[model samples]
Target: MAVYQLDDELWFPDPHLGEEDGLVAVGGDLSVNRLLLAYSNGFFPWFSFRHWKEPHWYCPLDRYVIFPKEIHISHSMRQLMRQNKYIVTFNQCFEGVIRGCSSVDDRNQEYGAWLGSDMIKAYTELHRLGYAASVEVWEPQDMSSGKRSAKLVGGLYGVAVRNAFFGESMFSLVPNASKLALIYLAKTLDGMGGLFIDCQFETPHLKSMGGKHISYDKYMGILNGEKDVELG
Candidate 1:
């Protein structure tokens, strides 16, 4: 399959035309409108920020997603939740969460790091416009004044289009912090009638947390309100 080159026009090729590896196009500005349109159609930009001058868009035919009701909570996570060692909040710290995802563990130093200054700026704008959100996990820290303040430890951020959430990136500062964020997000979405979380690709961790593969057509069906996702 030929890789399409994008220009100033706001458009994308048929997602089915994407290459086997899921890469469909390799040039486009990450304007808010472009990002919205891309995600609404199951396309997302992911490229090495330092290595590429333009965005690389991908839409995998095999979509990996997690229905809100199917998010798995392991025994360890359950125990941790009972302990109440951390605090979770939604959209309370968008910049902190994205910066943590971008820079945690020296991710920005890695060669294929996708979250950089431009992506951060763009997504921050998206958050301001209410199309993006963040789930923050904070650890309480005791201050010298005999008060306790929360420090940002871990969280995840993603874009939401109606009932579907397109996950972008997540970071963990302590063990199971990101998992807690995800579990919290899943439960919160479930309460609000969210259908699915578009994981974009499969990972063992995500699989363990109830992510599953469905055809792109089926994924789009739920996204477009044309069909309901079957929950197990």
Candidate 2:
């Protein structure tokens, strides 16, 4: 399959026509409208930020997702939850979460770093407009005044469209911090009748937490309010 080159026009080629690697197009600006359109149609921008001059959009045919109701809570995670060692909040500090995600492991200096300055700026604008959201995990810290304050430790951020969450990136300052955030997100979404979380790709971490593969057609059906499709 040929990789399409996007122009100044506000449109995308058919997602099904993407290359086997899932790259559909390249050279588009990450404007709010463009980003929203891409996500609404099951596409997302992910490329080596330092190497690529513009956004590279992808839409994989084999969709890996996590249904909120099916999110796995392992025995260890359950024990940690019972301990109540971390505090979780939604949209409390999106900037902190995004920055943490970008800087962890000095990703900016590494090749194939998708989260860069430009992407950060774009997503920050998305958060300002209520299109994006964050999940923050904090650890309690005692100040000199004997007052307790929470320090940002770990979290995740993503785009929310209707009933679906398009996960962007996540970071963990401590072991299982990111996992805790994901569990909380799943519970909250489950309560609100959320459909699924688009994991974008499969990872052992996500797979252990109940992420599963589904066809793009099924994914689109769920996104389009057709909830009767069977999940794999």
lDDT of each: 0.90, 0.91
Candidate 2: residue pairs that collide:
none
Candidate 1 Cα misplacement greater than 4 A, ranges: 106-111, 228-232
For candidate 2, the clash count comes to 0
lDDT of 2 by residue, 4-48 (tens): 999888898998888997889998799999999999999999868
Against the hidden reference, what TM-scores do the models get? 0.95, 0.95
Per-model RMSD to reference: 1.6, 1.5
Error of 2 at 194 (Å): 0.3
What shift in Å separates residue 228 of candidate 2 from its native position after superposition? Answer: 3.8
Model 2 ranges off by over 4 Å: 106-111
| Cα error, candidate 2, residue 221 (Å) | 0.6
